[model samples]
Target: MATLLLTGASGLVGSRLLPRLVEAGHTCRALVRSEVALPDGTTGVRGDLADPDALRQAVEGVEAVVHLAALFRTTDEDAVWRANLDGTRNLITAVQTYAPRARFFMASTGNVYDAAAAQPGRETDTCSPTAAYPASKLAAEALLADSGLTWSVVRLPFVYGEGDGHLASMPGLVDRFGLHPAHTYSVAHHRDVATVVGMALAGTFDGRVVNLTDDAPVTVYEMAAFAGQPIDGSSEPLVNPWAGRMDSTVLRGFGFRPAVPTMQAAARDGIL
Candidate 1:
C-alpha cells in the first residue's frame, strides 16, 4: 500500500478512480482547489496546479502521483495551456523537490495523434496536433519525460460508462468533427481506467507511453445508437478512417486486460 497524491479528484475520471484506489488499500490524497466531497478516507489537500507551496505540501511523502487534470473542449487556448502545460511543469517541479522517489502517472489524450494518420495512433508515432488541448498535453508529456522522474503516460481515448454522459455527447462531436458514420474510435470504460491505474501502482507501466482502450474499436454511428442518441447515418467514404483510433499493442504486451471490453457489452450489462 502506497500513499498517492492525485490531482483532478473532482473531474470525471478522477472522481471515479479515487474510490477504487482507496478500496485497493492505497492512501489517496486528493489535491483540490475548492471544498468538494471526496471519497471516504481520502485526505483533501487544498490547492490548484499553479500553487507551488501547495503542490509541495501535496507531494511530500507520497509514493506516487496521478495527474488527470486537463482542459479540453474550450474556446480559451490560454486556459488550456495554463492548466495542461504550465500546471504539469509546476507539478513536476514540486515532485522533483519534495517526492523525488515517487512514480508519476500522467493521463494524456489520444487526440494528440495526427488527424490524417493512415493507421491507428501508436506510442511512437510522430504527433503534430493543431488543437490547443492536445498540443499542450503533448508538450507536457515532453516535460515529464525530461523531468527524470519515473513516469508513465497513458493516452486515453473517448472515456465513457458509469453514466458519465461522455458517450452521449458523441453525436454532437460527430457533427463537429465531420466524421463519417462509419468512422471508428477507441474508448475505455471507467472501470478499465481503474484497472490501468492499478497497473501503474504495481510498477507495470513505468517509463512508457501507452494507449488505453477496450478490445473493440466501435463506430460513431453505433455508439450514438447505443446511447439512444443516434446521429445522421452516412454511406460516404470517411476522409480520416483512423482519426480517433489507437493501437493498444503496448498495453496488451504489459498484460493489461480491460474489465469492460466493449461498448456493446457495457450496454447489455447496464453499465453504460
Candidate 2:
C-alpha cells in the first residue's frame, strides 16, 4: 500500500476522504491544525500549512500527497491568498526537498474558470476568478504547474454533503428569498470530490486540469425544494449569481463521475 500524506484531513472533504483512502487499502498520514478524533489505523500529524518545517515533517516518508487544505471563501482576499498560495508554496518546497518523486494531487475549484453567463465550461476555458477564493485557487494551480513534480490539478464545483457548512446553510437562502432566482448554480457531492482526488492520486489520467461536476446544472429553486423548504415565490430574481456549470468530460474520460445527481438525493442521504 502507498503511504499518502493528506493535508486538511480534518475538514469537510478531508474527513470523508480519510475513510475512503483507508478503505481502499492505502495508509494515510494526515496533517491537522489540532488534535481531533480520527479513525483507527490512520496517523495524524499536527502541522500548520503555512510553516515549511511542519509541512516537511508531515510529508516525510509519504509516497503521494493529496492537498485539500485551503481557504474556501469568495471573500477575504488576503486570507485566501496566504492560505492557498503561500501554503501551496510551503508544501511544494518541502516536497522538493524531501519527496521529489511523490505524486502530488492538488484540489482546486471550478470557479477558476472565467465567469461566463453560460453553461458547461470546458477545461480549456480561460479563467476569470471573480472572487478571492477562485483567484487564490488559480494562483495555487500556477505554482504547482511549475513545481516539476508528477502533479495533477482537480477543479471541483460546489461540493455539498454532510459536514459541508456552506451547502447546509443554502436552504436558509431559499426561505429568505424565493425560487427561480436570477443566477444559476452547479453542485457535486463530497463523496465525488473525494473520489476525484483518489483517481488523480492513482495516476489514472494524463490531463493537467480536470473538472469535477455533476451531470446537470441545478438552480436555487431546485436545491431549496430538495431541502424540504421551497422558496417563497417564483418572481424573485436569484441574487449574487455565479457560474453554475462545468464540463466534466476530462474527469469522465478517466472513469470518474458523480454517482449522486439530484439535491434531494444528497439531502436524503445526509450529504447536504
Candidate 3:
C-alpha cells in the first residue's frame, strides 16, 4: 500500500478518488484550505497551495502526489495566474524538496488544444490554449516537467458523474437556451477519471501525457432528448464548443476505459 497525498480532495474528482483509494487499501492524505469532514483514516492538512512551506508539509512522506487543485476561470487574470501557475510552481517545488522520488500525477484539461482543430487530438499535438484555464494547465505541465520528477499528466475531456455540476447540469441549459442537436463533444465518467489516476499512482505509466475520455462522442441535443427534455432550435449558436474528440489509445494501453459513454446515461444513472 502506498501513502498518497491528494490536493483538492474537497472537489468532485478528489472526493470520489479518496474513497476509491481507501477501498483499494491505500492510505490517503488531503491538503485543504479550510476545515472539512473527511472519512476515518484519512488525514487532512490545512494549507494554501501558494505557500511552499505548507505544501511541503502536506506532501511529506507520501509515496505519490496527485495535483488537482486549480482555478477553472476568473474575472481577473492575475488571480488565475497566481492560483493556477504560481500555485503549481509552489507544489512542484515542495515535491522536489520534500519528496523528490515521489511519483506526481497532474489533472489537465483538453481545452489546452484549439477547439477548432480536427478530431482525436494526439498527445503530440501542439497546444493552443485560448482560454485562461487551459493556458494555466499547460503552464503547470511545463513547470512539472522541469521539476525533474517522474510525472504523468492526464489531459481530460469533459468529466461528468454524480455531483458534476457543469457537464451533468447541461440538460437544463439545453432546455433553458433551446439548443440544437449538432453540438457534440467527448466526455468521461468521474469514476473513469479516478480509475485513470489510480493507474498512474500504481506506476502503470510514466512520463506520458494520456487523454482520459470515452470511446464515443455525444451531442447536446441527444443528451437533452435522453433527459426527456424539449430540444429547442433557437440556442444553437451560443454554445461554447469543446476542443475536439480526444485519442485515448495511450490510456487504453494502460487498461483504462470509460464505463459510461453518453452524458444522458451518466445523468440518468446518477453517475454524472
Best lDDT among the predictions, by candidate number: 1
Winner by TM-score? 1
Candidate 1 vs candidate 3: which has greater TM-score? 1
Runs in model 3 lying further than 4 Å from the true structure = 171-181, 225-230, 234-242, 261-270
Total clashes for model 3: 4
Measured with C-alpha atoms, the lDDT of residue 74 in candidate 1 is 87
lDDT of 3 by residue, 61-150 (tens): 888998888886457877887888999888888888898999999998877877666656778889878678789889999888778999
Worst 10 residues of 2 by lDDT: 174-183
| Candidate number with the higher TM-score (1 or 2) | 1
The CA lDDT of each predicted structure is 0.93, 0.78, 0.79
RMSD of 3: 2.9
- Model 3 scores a TM of 0.88
By lDDT, the candidates rank as: 1, 3, 2
Residue range 1-272, candidate 2, lDDT tens digits: 68989888887788888888888888888888888887777888887887777888888888899999988644668888889899999999999889988899998887776665455677788776768788888888988989998899988777777755756466776555442543466678877877777778778763388888777767765666565556544565444455567888877888876778766677667667
User: Candidate 1 at 261: error in angstroms?
Assistant: 1.1
User: What are the models' TM-scores?
Assistant: 0.97, 0.88, 0.88
Model 2 local distance difference test score: 0.78
Local distance difference test, candidate 1: 0.93
Candidate 2 Cα deviation (angstroms), residue 119 = 3.7
